[model samples]
Every structure is written in C-alpha cells, then in structure tokens.
Target: MDSKIPQIIRKSFIKEIIKKHSNIKVQSGVIDLLSECTTVSVSYISTICNAICNRKGKKAIGDEEVIEVLSKMDNEFILNMFEELRK
Candidate 1:
C-alpha cells in the first residue's frame, strides 16, 4: 500500500488531539515529528492489515482485522483504550 496517509490523517488533526487531551504546549517541530511518526505507524498497520486480508482471501479490511492484529501484537492497552472509546 503506497497510498498517501495525508489524505486520511493530518497534522492539524494531531494538534487538535493533543490540545484536547493535554494542557502542555507542544512545539511545531515536535508536532511535525509526531505527525511523521503517526503517518509511518498508520502505514505500517495498514500494510499488516493488507497482508492479513490477503492470507484470509478477504477483499476488505475492517475493525476485526485491526483488533486481531493488535491482539496478536499484545497491545492490550491500546485495545482497551479503543474499547473504552467505543463507549
């Protein structure tokens, strides 16, 4: 998946998330680095999702696949966070 993640997530959205969650001010440079890291992480997950889909002979990527990947990676904290977000 060589697709651009910029279309899906942007720096402004990241800034908004930070602002919403924290009172500490963040520098533009740090925000830029975070944005880049977020992009890379999302891309990596997307790649894994694609591979999982291929192995399953599936044509789509959904939350189940994402949760499965996270579970396999033992990301219980993130999974729990997401589960809370759903409520």
Candidate 2:
C-alpha cells in the first residue's frame, strides 16, 4: 500500500514512533492509531518487534528489546519524525 509518509521518511518515522512511545502500552496504542490513521499496519508495533527479531543479524526481541532500539535512536531522527506528523 502507498504510505502517507514516503519510504525515505518512514524509516525515520519508525524510529520516532519507537522513541516517543517507549512504554509498551503507550507505544502499542500510538502504533495502532498511526497504523489506522495512515492505513499502515505494516509499521505497527508488533510488526516492529517481529521484524527486528526476524532480521538475519538480529536475535529474538521482546518489548524491552524494542524499547532499547527505539531509545538509542538519535534525537534528530526523532525531531524529523515528529515534524512530519504536523504535515
């Protein structure tokens, strides 16, 4: 499906979503809404954890793992991610 945010923008948006909503419950809710709003469940919260885990170089990742990856993302990426939301 087409995305509201292009692929180039999406990478950073994913990073932004992950970082902004570190708490699992909050993150899950945000992801759900964003997925609904954008029609982008392919980027949903559970999809992220599963995708990360399914990566060749990556091991299984749980909620904490997801949080860690999201937390370590750069602030600049996050800022851009938020900025796009205003658009």
Top lDDT prediction, candidate number = 1
Model 1 per-residue lDDT at 85: 81
Cα error, residue 50 of model 1, in Å, equals 0.7
What is the lDDT of every predicted structure here?
0.84, 0.56
Candidate 2: tens digits of C-alpha lDDT, residues 1-87: 465456536545765867787755445555555645554533454566776677745666665544545555544664465557647
- Give me the candidate number with maximum TM-score: 1
TM-score of 2: 0.25
For candidate 2, the per-residue lDDT at 87 reads 75
Worst 10 residues of 1 by lDDT: 1-10
- Residue-wise C-alpha lDDT for candidate 1, range 1-87, written one tens digit per residue: 446566346778988899999999999888889888877877888899999999999999988888888888898998999788878
In angstroms, give how far residue 51 of model 1 lies from its true place: 0.7
Runs of candidate 1 with Cα error greater than 4 angstroms are 1-9
